[model samples]
Target: MKQFDVERPGRAEREDRPITTTTPTHRLLPHPRDLVRFGPHDGAHRPAARVAVSVLVPLVVLATIGHVEWAPYAVFGAFASAFGRGLPRFQRLEMQLEAGLVLVACVVLGTVLAASSAPVWLLVVTIGLVAGLTSAVSDLRRWSPPGPLFFVFGLGVSAFVPATASTVAVAGVVAPASLGLALLASVAGALLPAGRRALATAEGRRWRRGPRPVDGRRTVVHAAVCLVASIAAGLLSLALSVESPYWAMVSAVVPVVGSATAGQLVRAGHRLLGTLVGVALAALLLAWHPGVAALILAFGVLQFATELLIVRNYGLALVFITPMALGMRALGGAPVDVGALVAARTADTAIGVGVVVVVLLATHRLRRPRPEAAA
Candidate 1:
């Protein structure tokens, strides 16, 4: 209700500022404390609760019906609600609708690929395209989480897992149903007294700000970068025989979301640090092998924590994200080789992050103006 932009800290205030390049040395090593610092609450609980409920309800229902295997589809659909946070009611609704449609499409597309037993090469190419297209769309729409991380995640995971015709049909129904619930949950807050007050205030009218100007060139460049990074990471991961190559692909796209080289490095650092710590946490949780109900609860709690910290500190949020992802894979009926999974996750992420760093550094050097140009 407070109209918080959880994507980037102070995004609104910084929107008009140009992205200036910084020297690599100054940007490479972020302050250690910055990695662990917590940002203001900024009403994170509201969206966190929304996303958790949106995700948990569907999982609970799937478990009740003895169809928990479909939980992945449901969870991805619910991801729609995670977008458009902290916007005015109507604008939020619009953004969520757009996001929901994209998410559902990804699930359906992934399901189809899974049912057909698409080859790994095809999966890599397809998800790379998805990443590029979604990156463009996300930038055009000014999505907070910005970039195609969720889109690639949903599509790649769906494609990697085995499925059949019946499962594809199930995904079609369950994903939309879950998406519908998420849309409702996103706006349900309007019924509350605080929400109503917020709606009546100037903050609610901010939607009248209208959309930002379209920067076609910027969008295209970013999309191309995402496409190339994903493909490179995916291919390299496969070459290394990582169990989950998509993880590398996903990691490659993370750094590209930052507005500048320095920001990119910071994001890359967060992704690596958070993931490493999260792998340890995931190992413990997988070892515990909690019951169905307990797993569902843990899923909800992790989702909540992820949303709460994600905007404040990307690295910290990843601590929960790593396990949440592994947990989802387990719920989807995948063979859980804890040792192999953990090791693969670490290796794949490292490879992905390393690739982006190299790419970024190379590009930065190329783009740097020579001394003669400065003169």
Candidate 2:
């Protein structure tokens, strides 16, 4: 049995490899240092600032207008700016446009479902389908974050929150405005002299080389994994009477996006550990009982920190992301039982991680070379 490399190729590349029953159990666990280690800065501040401004400006405006209930929709729309982080200006713009469209669609669907008061099962199925579809799309478009995590997240959170005809109309208007702002903010850097000079460099010209041809088979497999993982996590969370089942669904989708089994396990570990610590952070924040304006500012700060740390260390990013997410829910007017909320989120994340781990292991087992074939 060959040892699995931590940085091995993705599942698609390993499908034809000689497999064995004896797995490297050690590789299943991530090194402790890997969890804490941060990668190079690589100008993370630039995109971090873009995403923060995109989210902050809309939130401020909504707060000013005294329509903070619309903040969730705006936040999701601003998510569009988080894509295409390192691409050139034009490519980033194009990617953000596509992402914005997807985000807007998810928000619309979720809002409609919320207004209809759709059942839990229906929400599960709908989000699963969205996960699968968006997974394929992300792969085809070579999205940086890769997978349907944000799409499923947007749809699930929207559907979980209570909505009405009036609120739906509000979402229709607010979400798109936020998206447009995000687009402008994403490319606003181009106006700077430094941005213009960078664009003239070899790295900027690399976009002309075009994206690599997508592998349809791989895309199908990735989509299926995301769909099944999301549905399984959602159903399990519901069975356990978890308050926020979609958190489980979101966590499940995170692991499926990893490049390989070891990578998947690492991601799952990150998600679980991050959420746990984040839950504590969220609890403290909630205990403080920050005012609406204070919460909005905290949300912005957390968003900036999350974007800054995400690419470098996912687990660390979650420390900020968890609180940020809880704050967003509060802004959207979800009744906050601080104890219940944090407990449910923590439980939901654990369930999701467990589901994805089982799925990954089962798939790996099924794909392993048979004894006779090995002979």
Candidate 3:
């Protein structure tokens, strides 16, 4: 096992350390990558485990989507399988899932007690799954913020599916199938004795460093906020546009505003410029050939190639994702106007991205001189 030469930073030096833990908070800040390295101790996944998750999760999703009548079961099957596979070695994964379920249960129970609303039911997906996924892919070997993206799934399932006696009965088949598939992969990954030992000793002294305290609630709230804001922005643009309701002018974009004031401004400026560029290019290409499938395919290929380039650069990710997103709507088998919709969508995306930046700036308001942590 090779030792990590770099020192991990303490909580105080890290940017995500709570500035005001004494008060109630709603946002969780992300940690810098220095907290973890590409080593074995923290996020060591056997290639086999990775292969299972990467393959099975998607397959389950496709199944559930195809059987839309069983959306809850389908979604549940997809996520539970993923989590069960990742949980044994990562205690945090279990903790976050349990903690999230508990918190949401309290909220649901409280609502019931209040009697201010209807006798609504509750479903819960583990937020820990999203947290674990991020942790899995992220370079941070140390702790990252906790969030139950799965909770969103739970809400969707419960709100829409109604977990009744019949639903519970159905779950008997679904839960076991989901758990059996997910947990099997994790167990196999853990059983590889050579793999486990290698992971533990892979980063000796660096392995002993303190981990970050994850703000689970913050991550959940902010992620919800971003998603909500994007949806609203998309709808608003739709209302303002000359297009009809069915042609919502490409409103399904997710904005990536800054976490700081300056970052917000930069994000806004970048998106504005990027949108203008995309629209102009789209116009020119559309002009060249109004009925060009080959051009569209070429553009699609270009968009995917650019996504690979954006791996190390988030802003670039947005650039390529934006074009590809617009392309999906543009090339869909519908009687939609290609040029006008593209222009409108580009405009709407820029506006939504601007709103995201402004909101982040207004809220986080980050400043310099916080001092560099160990990255």
Q: Each model's number of backbone clashes?
A: 1, 0, 4
Ranking by lDDT: 1, 2, 3
Top of the candidates by TM-score: 1
lDDT of 1 by residue, 1-375 (tens): 233322332443232211222324224444555556665676788889999999999999999999898888999999998877656766777888888899999999999999998889889999999999999998888876678989999998889878999989999999999999998998787778766776676656455436567667567766887898899999999998988789999999887864456667777888999999999999999888877788899999999999988777888889998998987767755568899889999999998899888877766544333567457
- Can you give the lDDT of residue 196 in candidate 3? 60
Runs in model 1 with CA error above 4 Å? Answer: 1-33, 202-209, 332-335, 365-375
lDDT of 2 by residue, 1-375 (tens): 111111112321221211111224324544555556655665677778889999999999999988898888999999999887766766677888898899999998999999998898999999999999999998888776778989999999899988998878988988899999999987676667766765676654344326477657567777888899999999999999998788899999887764446556767788999989999999999888888899999988999999988777778789998998987767755577999888899999999999988887766543333467457
**Per-prediction TM-score, please?**
0.89, 0.87, 0.41
List candidate 3 stretches off by more than 4 Å. Answer: 1-88, 95-187, 198-259, 262-311, 315-348, 364-375
lDDT of 3 at 336: 48
- Model 3 scores a TM of 0.41
Give me the candidate number with maximum lDDT: 1
In model 3, the Cα lDDT at residue 182 comes to: 48
lDDT of each: 0.81, 0.79, 0.36
